[model samples]
Target: MKHILSLFLIHTFTSYCQDTTYNHFSVDAEFGLNNPIYPMTSGYDAATLNLWHVGLGFRYAVNPKFGVRLSGGYDNFRELAGTPSFSSEYYRVSLEGVANLGNIMDFKEWTKHIGLLFHMGAGYSVLNGSSIDPNHILHGIIGFTPQVRLSPRFNLYVDGSVLANIYQNYTYDLNSTRNTHGIDAYLINLSLGVQYNFGRKEHADWVVIPENNEEIQNLRKRVEKLEEMQRDDDNDGVANWLDQEPETPAGTLVDTKGRTLAPRDSDGDNIPDDLDDCPFEKGSAAMKGCPERSGSMAPNSSKEVITMIEESEVKFETDKADLSPSFQQLLKAIAKVMKDNPSYKLHIMGHADDRASEEYNMNLSRERANAARTYLIEQGVSGDRLTTEGFGETKLKNPLRTVEARAENRRVEFDVR
Candidate 1:
């Protein structure tokens, strides 16, 4: 008894000493009824049902699925009425192997509160009663316990067991001698009990260790990276993963790669290339980046040139800045007039319909004007003789929100000086 108490104390101390994911120790206490059968002298039968039976055990889990237990129990068997009455006291101590069958079979997949265990082992038992001396016996016991979890710390259980006694010296009545051989007696006990768990937040019996923890962790990292990539820090309609200029100013026009559409100035001119009449030449801003025009062409002739350029105004597809073959031909004609009047200079103005955001439309209009200027230059018109500007949707030729009206609005016209 002292040794048992010492062992219990050691287990308790160890259970509280370490922090772990799951607990590995538990203690059980139970009380119920027991019945004895066999090895009874004739005319000396014991009671059909006996009342006193109790058991206590300490368990240590080797892993989630298997463990061992040290257990002790006592039983009282009394003789039946109308017979020569006798009584016996039975005491037992055992070391049992325990299998967590519920975990092995994955009961958690179907139920959270139910569990089962199977235990079996061999032990020593002593029987003493009446005026008889104590009789020692070797016993083998097998049992099954079914349990329901009541809380994190407790489980309620019922156990049924069979103890087969070998080499018995006296009958259960304790009134006569019995065979000292194998399998001489049998005892059955039924008990209700509570198992108290110690150590850890979760018990080992209920923890399901993942088979591939590294793989799960890697997958979690990948999901986090994807979430980060999807964030749009500038709210520019472009994901961070694909945005080249993530911090572009609000309402600024951008391209598919998230770069600003504001045009560059190749020459050191104050005007951007899209609007500079002389993109590659350093010229005065007063002449629209062209060398001071030798002098102004005749006002009447400039008017005629301007009327011709306006009459041949080029229209573009919605949201498009590229010039069609027909529009290119019209630009060639205008370029010829500029050549004929060498002193004449043209100012190209671009416009757009109200189909998109202001900044987007503004960029689109500038590109249209630049396209026309490029074509005229390709036809031998000097860059310095042309100036360009964009009005976005502000100077709409047709204000009505109709397809034809919008189409008419998306055009480029010229003014001559």
Candidate 2:
């Protein structure tokens, strides 16, 4: 377990630093021909083999690296020899693992959907045949399945598989016999099937809105009014009421207390743009928050990483612990950071597991949230910048667990802007 955890962390951190990838699931049904191999002594080639199979299955596209599928088929077998020889009907299950090549943009699912797929599993034929024994039919499978996405979230899979009995004995006596797993003897067939994909979606794809001149102007006017109320209209580091940096020009940054800070190059290089030995010299974050470049580079720019991060669990300590100083401090720091960075909002979604009394937990979470706001105020943060809510115990973090589960009962998390 320790080794596994380390490997998982390595893989996760590596993948996190890489580009984004997506996956999906699907189910399908199809029909195809089944040919059986008969011994020369029993009769001619096994053309009498006809297949009628109904399959129910699930597929998982693990990652761009690999994926898999599982399918169970119930089939009726018949021999097409001179006389219609009905063998037995049986259930067969197959699992296939596929490897994806380099993925293209449009064929996003193909990395998980399409690839070279190999199968290995056990199956059985249960019908009583004149010369067939139920215990003798140990089955094996192997093949390739390629998938194509016809539309977003809807995929098509076509596969060719080989299924056969492991024993060389084409003819089976009434007595039961065992066969080696890897070796193939009498079984042989080629099949083709298709499946439609479902589930995966691209919800985060941006929905764009053209610039509204009226709305922009309205927002500007609201900002002006907010400044007027403060009455520090110069927008300097010092407020008009306490102008310590009276000489400081307009457009200077102000702290929460409206105090001025020393002027320094945030993106530090020995040569500051204004008086640097080399203004154009590129440097590290230590010298300046900005990096000098041959061409213009925006500070906010980043390589987009499209991620589907599932919600995290929120756990509550004991009832009395809700009022602990540690808890208050935690909320205080969180609220302060969020208020300062208005562009990044913290989503305070409070939820509880089904074990709690709905009204009780709801009231409890609400009260705890009020405490959260008060602590933030003590940290010199504004209340209008935050919102809170309680979901009672309606949604569960894990339905499989009962009340004792940690984080299953209560939680909170943050999302990027």
Candidate 3:
């Protein structure tokens, strides 16, 4: 029995090695026996036989879905009868294997699956009945077994078959001659049991694997949507890792290496504030986006800068500097900036729209500038930091041929020293 099992294992392993492919294999050892009753005689009616089969085998699961196995073992049968006190033994050794035809369920992954297995094949064996002078009975055999799998590589196996070719006869003096039959039922030596996954196992083919796609447009879109939900814009190449702005859109202006673009210095302006620079000017790099000017300018020191302007068409309503109340909030906002930056002292010099005497307009301009200055002081600005000048009708910001041009001449601006 050991020799036959050894031969089967050698063939199974050698075949697997030659293929050089991935396959599942399991080694199994099975032991089983059956008992029978013979009640033909009444004197002592109970009789039984202890028939056992023991063997080891190997199975190759070629694919996740199907497999084959070659296995065989030894069979021992002891018969006990009580009708005239008779006893005998039958010994048989068999080699059988199977081709797994198919599986009931599709097993594409490493998960729990329920399925049925159909096995059809047989074994060759040497048999003998101890009572009949003990010669050997040899025969070719055929059978089948159906099984169920509780897990991958684990199963409950069953088999039964019929035997042909050898018979034995024994005559007893106490009764008529009796002849034992040569043909036998295979299920008569049936076995049942379970199998485990055991050692040196491979990863389950059914498990799902993860994937990656480089620089895909769709993935980019998804990233954008996600960023929008988070609210970051500028899309400057800053990624989430380096990105202080969490709301950046996906695919924003990023660098060649996929990071957000460094803050742009398109004009080489020293100032980096995108919102502070004039769009049309070519600003200085060190000045932070502010362009250099050729006109006489007051230094920004202490914020109380003094400057001059020529305007003639600008006008004032009598002595009052009140802008149409509609412009009140606008004027107030300017006042707030002064309050916020206390060093910002402004000088408002008003002018007539070239329609009044220079003296009268100059007087009116001073009063108007003073009136405007009063409003800022009222809005929390320091009176000492402000001054009013009356350029009157002597200066014109634009040609006075048109009323709209005249209107441009009347304005107020902060002067810094």
TM-score of each predicted structure versus truth: 0.49, 0.35, 0.33
What residue runs in model 3 are displaced by over 4 Å at the alpha carbon? 1-24, 35-51, 61-68, 80-97, 101-116, 140-187, 194-417
Q: What ranking of all candidate models by TM-score puts the best one first? A: 1, 2, 3
Q: Give the TM-score of candidate 3.
A: 0.33
Q: Return the TM-score for candidate 2, rounded to 2 decimals.
A: 0.35
Q: What is the Å distance of residue 366 in model 3 from its true position?
A: 99
1 against 2, candidate with superior TM-score? 1
Ten contiguous residues with the weakest lDDT in model 2: 202-211
lDDT per residue as tens, model 1, 1-417: 999998898676456625654677888999998889887889987777687899999898877789999999999988888988777899999999999999889998999899999999999999987688888889999999999999878999999999999878888887778656888699999999999888656676676774344677899899999999989888766788889999987755555567666544445566764455544445577866544434564322435336645655788988899885445546755665577678888889999999999998998999999999999999899999999999999998889999999999999988877
Q: Candidate 1 has what TM-score?
A: 0.49
**Model 1, position 370: C-alpha lDDT score:** 93
Instruction: Indicate whether candidate 1 or candidate 2 has the larger lDDT.
Output: 1
Candidate 2 local lDDT, 257-342, one digit each (tens): 55554333312354333332222234554544234444564322322100111132234654421533323434543443344455
Instruction: Please state every model's RMSD to the true fold in angstroms.
Output: 17.7, 26.4, 23.6
